[model samples]
Target: MRVRAESPGPSWADVGLAEPGHGWSGAVLAALLRRRGAAVLSHDTAAHLHGMPTPHAAAPSSLVHVTLPPGQRLRREGVAPHRRDLPAHHVGAVHGLRATTPERTWADLCTRGAPWTPEDLIAAGDHLLARPWSRRGRREPASTPEGLAAVVAALGGVPGIDAARRALAQVRVGSDSPLETRVRLDLIAAGLGEPILQFRLDAADPQCPEVDLYYADGAVALEYDGAHHLAREQQARDARRDRWLLARGVAPLRVTAEDHREACRRLVEVILGRRAAGHRIDPRPESTSQSGHDAPPAES
Candidate 1:
């Protein structure tokens, strides 16, 4: 089993040589390989050594996540170990170990770039959240919410402990159901007011209820629709849902992936005019997010 180095020091050769590739320690394993002129990647380099996955961007890998004590230096010239305080719950494990359980990994990446999604985050929770803290099972409840309201708010982006709290806020999962959570983050970043989530329409067609975004009281609905909505059957069903909504004297504002923030701005304008009886509304505009390090590995 792969294990953390117990209070490891840097040099391997100084400790004494083992037969062939045999007596080398982890540090020695890395150093002697460098001496032989082979390029090596450390940290979560090999697949699934720890929960952190293959990086999205193309930078050389380092044990960038495994923190070292302040004033300590890397033995290999120019190679640096990232230094951060170890989380309290990490017991019986060496500090500066080259891993951060999935949850901790996700928390570190949020909004700081390594590019993660709500779905990836939720999928990670299955292995990470509320688990035992043995050295082997290091995932923890660092960033998720225990309740729904907090889930939505945690959906708001922050860093470290705050980011963990935001991720926890809206913990609903499944390969299929990230709609509300996805839309909320998009809208907030776009500077639009938050909309009501999971609104349901009640009428004669109780057999097939529509998952709505806006309320008829002049409040607009915003759906976190994905490409799946464009599939033949889903599109037909959406058409029917729209017609039913129209018949009830409600005007439905539809948005697709191509037109997110602009569409939201128009809808909010409509809501202000229709719901508040011609009162002018000016919603703050949001800037778009940029591509980050975790763009997923390129096809070889």
Candidate 2:
């Protein structure tokens, strides 16, 4: 049934969770849930919003029980809104406004139990990884204001990213990172489309390059050109591969540490588009290699 916020006030429905930075949306929703009789758990009320579904709970619906303030009788719905101090970790923001950040939510999700399978967690990470940086205007990080918002935005979420981020921190990649995850949150906030990750090309071998990050159907392949590729033998092999693919019309975009951060979206677009529009660069096509009947080309 549709809940409303009314009565001496509007029906609880009118007080649903609001968009980030909405007008008293957070406060209103908080009150409405309390009215619903959702005995709010003291340690975590953002439970629903921050944590995962409690499949094992007897009453998954009532799993959330809020403890409302003494005089704020919730006449709207049966759910109750708990008014207790949130632990340090549970506090953060999402989509700009102050709410629970994804990282914190992940940690909280883990702490709660195995409500979500290991695959679920991995999928969630994959789901959120490609995200870009934050676009919301500055929210003071504590003291500094100029460029401080970026810092605050980075630190705004859960600590899980610290591990994920650190784990893949050293690995040189063109698009995302080692776990085959998506881009970091900060990249998403900066206004970017999630680039295709780990896509397969129709090459004879069809073996995807280990370092490929952003790939288009037939467009460019953005390879994070790390220090490893600088070795003489590796460089020679890469040059051959580049020439071979160029002959087949697949332009390879070598993104460096600097370029990946600065020109991510544009670089991805140009490569993808170029390949689509018949870029001169060639890529080795799968299942179309020369037939065995054709002898190797005579020595030039």
Candidate 3:
């Protein structure tokens, strides 16, 4: 099926109907591949294929990005052509469609002249290095810090490589969501030292719960409660975990989706030995304290 009419010729042809779940973009990519034997998806297109998180500020575009050889070009109404000879190792198959590897896609994105902020780039890198847990179990990270470093080194002297390097320095493993990365960056910018990611209270206990971000010196744990935490079952589980931490003298700070900045502020206050006043900081009842005594609203 032709995707757009204003193209020089047919944008995409339906050779055989795309696989059941390939989606429209996948179908378009398949058609482009058939027409141009050496086209590979790159940039944002490849990032989506690899399951990277989209920046919240990014405006949706209908353009499909494809990279072709230096002398070859395929300009169409709904297509953005990048003419560069990608190394063989940088190209890979994602769900049957050829696309840039996660590392290459990241490098391409950093240098693509897009308006991605430093935090945006760091979040993307954290995603690439994150080993998140799912119903199936802990999933393997898409790429490693070393792998990303290699990509930057290979593309040295390329425009925007410096920005990529700067972001990479701040990228850490174990960030489950962009919000977590954002909060961590905010804390660092506020002059709070970097908190440990995925800190387990007991290393020997396989069942020990891990805190999203832990400041050992202050014994504070910051949990970024995303929308998923609003579920009744998850909330109960979180409550139990908070109680467990409280019993151990660790201050558990629950940060919901609505008030991350406030949460960070409370955390800094806790670290500086001052009680934060105003909006609720702890997930427990206002009257309860870590010591199981009736406590005032603010920590003392």
How well does each candidate superpose onto the true structure, as a TM-score?
Answer: 0.43, 0.32, 0.81
TM-score of 2: 0.32
Evaluate residue 160 in candidate 2 and report its C-alpha lDDT on the 0 to 100 scale.
42
Selected candidate, larger lDDT, 1 vs 3:
3
Where does candidate 1 have its weakest 10-residue lDDT segment? 286-295
Q: Write the per-residue lDDT of candidate 2 for residues 25-134, one digit (tens) a residue.
A: 44455544444442233213343343332332233343333444455444334343434334455345431223444444433343333344333343343333332224
Pairs that collide, model 1: 56-296, 143-164, 144-168, 145-168, 150-169, 151-169, 151-170, 154-166, 213-221, 214-221
Q: Which candidate is the best by lDDT?
A: 3
Please state the error at residue 69 of candidate 2 in Å.
Answer: 28
Find the candidate with the highest TM-score and give its number: 3
> CA lDDT of 51 in candidate 3?
71
Q: Can you tell me which runs of candidate 3 are displaced by over 4 Å?
A: 1-23, 261-263, 274-300
Separately for all candidates shown, the number of backbone clashes (residues 3 or more apart, or on different chains) is: 10, 66, 1
Q: How much is 66 displaced in model 1, in angstroms?
A: 5.4
